[model samples]
Target: MSTRNSLRSAFLQLKRRSSTNTGGVWSDFSKRPTTLKINNAPIRQTLFSEGNSEEGPASLTNGDERLAYHSPIAIDETFQMAYRILEKEANSKYQIVDRLEKSLKNAASQEETIEIKDRIDKNLIEAEIENPEVLYNAEFADSKLLDKSQPVYRHLLKEKWENYDLLVTMQRLEQLHVIPDTLPTLVPKADVKVKFTHNTEDQFSKWVTPGSLLPAFAVSEPPTVYIQEFDRVEGSNNLYTVLLVNPDTPDLATNSFTTTLHYGLKNVMLNNVDNSIDVSKLLKVGPRITFKEYTPLTPEKNAPAQRACLWVFRQSKEIGDISEASENFDIREFAATHGLTPIGAHIWRQKFDRSVPGVRQMYGLGEGRVYEKVRSMDPLNL
Candidate 1:
């Protein structure tokens, strides 16, 4: 197979696995190659691309819609509750209505979108006889995860679960009880040389603090990451795992978060500090690979700032035979269960607020594109 074809096939395999395990969002993702030329060099595009006409309001079509249909059933139940609450509050109902309309218009299929619109419109026109809480009881009758008292849970519904990826990450962290008070520092100050070289600038900051958003253009492609542990003992076989995740996939329908495991590497032998690990090259190795490759960063407009996180873990020998953990690999669970502790980490924020000329070339989005800013949850919220 051609190189491009081979890569696409690999992604197809992952897409099937993701759909089967994680609600099947990837199964419906577009197969077209979305490419862009930056400084006369081409870069890969985001995983999902909703093929909406370029002339229409960008708000109507951005990010993934499959997440809406195949999301956890609880999300749909929550949306129903939000709909009922916003219905009673006449003062702030229009804003919610407009958002809902946009989502309905952008549904994955015409039939599905129409069905949703009809059901919700019917509810809106009917008399407010039933309490929204009553619907919650009926819909989530068997669910223990729902808690009305916790605004955070309610907030997830309000935001349409856009922070789904981050929330899941936080859930794992909370389970392990890591980072008791403050968010852990993303990148530790070490002798490592890390830089994301762009034509406009090069990012070599000593550290990136949590809760800050970096422009998507600044991180269009994977950065050059190198680590050197001078304190390593002689004749030691030290294997490390590097993980990159985006927990802020803006679901256009519900405006909630869904996560994408952008990149992950396991059993990478870090023999010496002088040698560096090139992430892009490592992706070429196959079969055992968890995710396909380092997908370029393109945070959708009108979505929350994406938390682009990188975590490093030192593998322990006692935690043997981790080859079985592939589909929907949960980093938090893997770390806790396998006794792997994160040694170094870093985070970059990306939002689709500004026009990235580079990305425009890839998606065929013309100039003067403006992405409405939306409120995203803090990573430390968990």
Candidate 2:
């Protein structure tokens, strides 16, 4: 098989795993390849080891110095109950009728079309508790994981779920329990030399902060034939990019990399963020990249740095080359919904070349960077 084909098959394998895993990876993740850690030693000795391996000292003690960072772990469940009740109340018939009547009066389209859609919206809101019917039933959940023939969920919730009382309740829920999620902290400093940059320290500063998205891509949609698949999910865009920066660096340092990475960038696809719980338009990551650390910077200038280094150029030929390989991805049905013809492999290789960022010299403390920005647990989600 062609090199591209092999890579494409591997991409499909990963998506299958992610879909099968119910736990949504916490808001962030690593860019480094996976490796195992040995944890066979006693917890107390392993955690408190000073490296000298002497018997326990009589008076020496360490607790807070162990680099422990904590966040709320005990989640409050009351908020879930309260939100569900309020959501039901807000979706009542009288409320739906009032909103639909107002929108019908305000629409700009042909009066009949507007009236039809408005009535459908109202009726959907009023009759949502009923089970799915024939070809015209409105879906009413915050999900698009259903078949394309199924409709995306939307209703009175979009217009009415905006009250701040919901926010107030959610914030209060964070206090209900001490749910602490801990992660490794960035190295205080790196003593290393990065060869790729004019000034390695300047580049290393940016890799410490984290942001939105992950590295992913889906196959371009296939050409629609007779009886094209009808998308039950709507309003999802077909392109997306993931930023793998570290947050520990000063904000200004990363500004350049951000612009440099995305400026006038072409061919990269964005994921559909509108209604699905799944990762949309994700590009499959191949084994073309790796991370390398610089040794040290000391004396007149003491410094530590972690740079994202690319070791391989040609990724595996799983099933084919870039485009042909991508055929194994499940991006076509959604594309067909919008009336566009599906794209093929040759175009995908072009996409692969254009979209990936220049990480030849990314530096940072890696994953410990993006700490402050992740959103807290939604009481409703709990």
Candidate 3:
């Protein structure tokens, strides 16, 4: 049937169902007389008990009165603001979907097409419910699509739940160029695993999420890390360099991306250069040469949490010793000059807020000093 005819039929069916349902509820309405009238003697609504206003002009003085109140100006302003935000969001969503759809329509292969389609579907779902709470509450809120490791997504949830410190840290990671702009992007299968290990503890970990204990517990002891790629360099001597930096230092006021180096290690040789060795257990053989020793992360009081970013770069054979490098280390320039390609990176956060006084004391920052530090770090005064 035609669309118009189908709608008409549907409406007729609904009307019939409504009339017949619930013991013929609509039958009483249908049987009511269409014409009805009353004597024009001024109908008296029981304003207060059973009083007639016509008895005396002032007889109904004790009646309850209600005045309709509304703030049309404020309501209109709020509605306009809401509309603008929603409009901007909707426009952004449609643009992304359109762009993705176009790309998929022109996809080269079936495999690529399927991948693109999946991404499109995921985008649509994300746009439909931008709020994390709605998605979290949904029955079909697929865990596969929800990447809590993503800085933005993680921060949204943290902000919703009032995890203030980690939220700032996550945002700082993005701002400092530690994480790529296109992140939450899939890592290629060929990429090697560069993992972190604790010196005091035997357990190893991959991702250092904000919710994890790495933020607080890691400050006690330095963590050991080894890259898998250097071990696999067959019949050739390869050295690696590691550097860690905290961009949120002096957290005194505003977050300045200018960094303070936490640790640096250089001239790292993988196991014995001669014998065949397992790449996975390279740290078990012997400790590599340490250029700069690990310094514990110390964030100032009343500041945003600090992100301790560790970058591992493959040392070029042409470059000599870099042991005397200063704390104001430049990772990008050092990489370029020495032909050092960054193999992997890791990040963990730390904070010295009022909630954790013991942590502040551990760093030798006194209570008076902490208050002074708070004054210095206030962004508003700056």
Candidate 4:
């Protein structure tokens, strides 16, 4: 019993020494105070405390400083707050513009008008600076973000057309012989899109492709033309002339084809944004713009397919009195006489169908003639 007691006492002493000794293997596992006394004050030791001793805790008021200490959730909240502030500022700016425009229209004095115009100019400059991405990243630009009056959006549209639509239009023109057939050649500088919206229920009411074949009923009425100008000249709207001629009008007497002018517009004012010439515009200012009112192409029965060549020209100056459209209209001579620069063109094909007769009667075109199908004896004649 004495020897057992001595062995137990010795074991207890050894365990206590191991627990207290700092050099022992079990010293790290022993219970110790979480903080150390520094200058008679308790200082909590932390992983980051030592490294950040020189700099104090991150600021809660400053966004840049607070972001350093924020978690992902907190960062997201900060971003949303910033977005809301920016949106509010944008709305306020637009409201100011609307108020200014209204005030300008109802200004009482010349001084007031001048002051309002100056403010508007300043606002436009600010908008232009803030909205340059629309021009640079045009391909991914949203249509809702585009402001037609802004030059940046206009330039973007111009670049877009030149990059994609213009190339396709040029290819179609060359392939279909619209260049040589209508005019000797063309150097297009503007983008043109044509559509006939007379019959909304018809399939061709939307913008027509450059070389599409349309049924007679689809294009029985006058077309709406959009001419987008890329070259911008400040404080001046360009004068344009639009001509629609059919280079495939059958001449039964000569056994060949002749050109006929179906529509003509002269001295029509156009700008980057306000570019379309539609029925409403005609109704508003028909006498000033219309050189020759629209006459629908009424193909005779048994006639071959016809090409409706639409041409757009940029005039150096306003054109003077011009003769009315006729069956043998000379497009080239008229363009030369008026110094009209060919800037854009479009074409669509039409053939005789059941709808042609009704369309002719509606347009006041008297009885149409039917041509006999001429056949050749030679197999290679086809």
Q: How accurate is candidate 2 locally (lDDT)?
A: 0.24
Residue pairs clashing in model 4 are none
Candidate 2: residue 168 lDDT (0-100) = 32
Q: For candidate 3, lDDT tens digit of each residue in 14-70?
A: 434332112221112342221111111232112111223224322233434212221
Best by lDDT: 4
Best candidate per TM-score, number? 4
Regions of candidate 4 where Cα sits further than 4 Å from its true position: 1-145, 234-237, 375-382
Alpha-carbon TM-score of each model against the true structure: 0.39, 0.21, 0.39, 0.63
The alpha-carbon deviation from the true structure for residue 212 of candidate 2, after best TM-score superposition, in angstroms, is 11
lDDT of 3: 0.46
Model 2 over residues 1-382: C-alpha lDDT tens digits? Answer: 4875565445434434333212211111252111111122333222222222232221235544333322122111232234345435534643565666677667777756556565654454343333211111222222223232212223322222224322332232232210010111111110111121122354322221111121211111111011111221122323221111121122233231110111111122222223111122122321221111121111011111211211101111111112211112222222223232321100000111211222211322122222234333332222
Q: Give the Cα-based TM-score of candidate 3 against the true structure.
A: 0.39
Model 4 over residues 1-382: C-alpha lDDT tens digits? 6985565456444434333222321112242111111111111111112223123233234655644442332332353344345434544555677789999999999779778866765554343333212222344435333445554456667767888889989988888888898899988888899998887774688789888988778987789898877665334338889999998887655657789998899988888667889889988887888778788787887777788899999888988888765788889988898999999999888888888888888888887988767744333322
Better of 2 and 4 by lDDT: 4
Evaluate model 1: give its TM-score: 0.39
Who is ahead in lDDT, 1 or 2?
Answer: 1
In angstroms, give how far residue 364 of model 4 lies from its true place: 2.0
How accurate locally is residue 293 in candidate 3, as Cα lDDT from 0 to 100? 54
Q: Which of the predicted structures, 3 or 4, would earn the higher TM-score when compared with the native?
A: 4
